[model samples]
Target: MNISIHSFTLKLRDPFRISYESRNEQEALVIQLSDTNQQGQTVTGLGESTANNYYQVSIERMQKEVALVRERIEEYSLANEVLNAGQVGTPGHLWQQLQPELQHSSFTLCAIDVAAHDLYGKKVGQPLYKLWGLNPADAPTTNYTLGIDSIEVMIRKMQAKPWPIYKIKLGTPEDLAIVRELRKHTNAVFRVDANCAWGVDETIENAQELKKLGVEFIEQPLKADNWDGMKEVYQHSALPLIADESCIVEDDVAKCAGHFHGINIKLTKCGGITPARRMIREAQRHNMKVMIGCMTESTIGISAIAHLSPLLNYVDMDGALLLAEDIATGVTITTDGVHFPDENGTGVQLLTPSPTSLV
Candidate 1:
């Protein structure tokens, strides 16, 4: 068993501004796991996790977390020669084994869990989506994000991309005004995300007005801990509400059941595909709409999100599309839709060789 780590500073085409924060550069940790499988094939799998100030996750912290378990990880993999051989030792089982060291940093846990799944898929010679029996044709169209900017600049972005759906970030006083103005230019479907910036009354009011402008849904209007407030808005708001920060892990799914109409699971937030699959199933059991989103990451993370699209009602995997340049090659998302590469394991190949170390 071998592990290699590399970090990159991903430059965005424009400064990505959500309600809580804005960033021009995103720091990402991409790791590769190599091991000879039971069939004696050397396979390497890729995984990614980005630094997020909102979540208080830093590259230094993730690196330390990985270092803490480095020896155990290698030893465990070596001892269990057929570690990921079959369902007996799945990604979920691996996640449990590493939980003690990585539990403090979901970002770190996500990277390893995703890499393990990618490795398993490659060992079996199948993509994760295909292995799960999902059809690419059933996947939903992903929406391109438009950060907060002047209405004129926003309109220009809309004109430039001309996508089928646009996720318009809102939190300013001129929120509806921006949407109304952008609506005049194109008939593209609009989805508004306040990023936990609106109040209960404000959310209800905006929902009614935004619904009239063809806005499909509202995402994380109030603060994540404001369940009392969300209850009132959920019942009164004209548009459906999707929870982002409110739903972090599998346990949060049931907690968000009555307050939110759906959930937007970020792979990094929920600790990758293994637990994310459980989160999706739990959300479905509660009869809630399920969505998967991405941060301003490279194709390594975005490609992992793409394979989960077939299980979602909505998708926000346009993270890589907003990049000025990408560091890896994987599933490609274009204006038309997502295109998977002709290879397996999220179809990711780093454009450059891994660095000696990211510390």
Candidate 2:
């Protein structure tokens, strides 16, 4: 059994803007696990979104868990048992069986699942989606995001493009005025992502106000833990609510089942594709709609999500659309929506890191 880890920097195609802030580049960590079996060999690769302390946590955990997963893979190999890739319930149990010192690391638990899936995908020669029973042809239409900018600037940005649907970032009451002005420009089916910036009363009032302006949904209007407020807003507001920060982990879905009408599942927040798929299924079981989303990731991460977006109820994978230039290949997003990779596996092409100045 062997494990290796490497860190890479993913430069954004442009200065990615959101309700929180903007960034120019993203750093990523890739972990690979391998077992020595000349006749029946297995290898797995997992990537984590890099930026600030987020990757730091996953990277440190990956460093610690790589050896443990390697040992587990070796033991499984020796037992000659079929290593199921889509076995979600097994890993949770296996993690608990580990030593008490290694019991509570979320990153380790997440990395184990990712590695298992990657290895399974390689062995079966099928993409992750195929293993999960998703079709590439049925990819969902994604909404292009408009960052927190002046109404005029946002309008100009929209005018310069031809995206049918757009999502506006709204964090303050001032955004209400922006939405009002935006309504005068185009009648596109628009959504709002408040990013947990509003309170219960404010979200309720804003949703009511925006309802008349043809806004489609209000995402994460209140804080993640504000379940009572979210339920109150959901009951009284005409606008549909989508959860973002509130539903970070799969288990969190049950907590928000009645509070939000929909959830925005980002691969990073859910740890990776394995947990993300589980989250989608859990959301469906609870009758909550799904929105496939992304962090400020490059095409590698977005491409991974694009493969699964077609099966989701809503898609907000415009993270690459906001960039000025992309790493090229894997997935392509047109004004209409996103397109999945035609190749087997994740369909993400990792390009040779180039020397380019950050915008």
How close is every model to the real structure, measured as TM-score? 0.95, 0.80
User: How do the residues 41-160 of candidate 1 rate in per-residue lDDT, one tens digit apiece?
Assistant: 788888999999988998888888888878766665522233442344566677888887677678998998888877867776788788788998778999999999889999898898
Scored by lDDT, model 1 comes in at 0.87
Question: Candidate 2: misplaced stretches above 4 Å?
Answer: 1-4, 32-46, 52-119, 353-359
**What is model 2's C-alpha RMSD?**
4.7
lDDT for model 2: 0.66
* Candidate 2 lDDT score at position 136: 67
lDDT of each: 0.87, 0.66
Candidate 2 residues 1-359, lDDT tens each? 34455555556543555656666666555544454333475544344354445334544454556555556544543112334642332332343344244434444444444444444444455666776687766777788777776667778887776677888888855888988888888878889999778888888888888989999899898878888888899899888899988988778889888899988887666666666778988999999999978765656566667777867988877766665565535678786566656554455544654343211
Hey, what RMSD does candidate 1 come out at? 2.1
**Model 1, C-alpha of 201: deviation from truth (Å):** 0.7
Candidate 2's error at 163, in angstroms?
Answer: 1.1
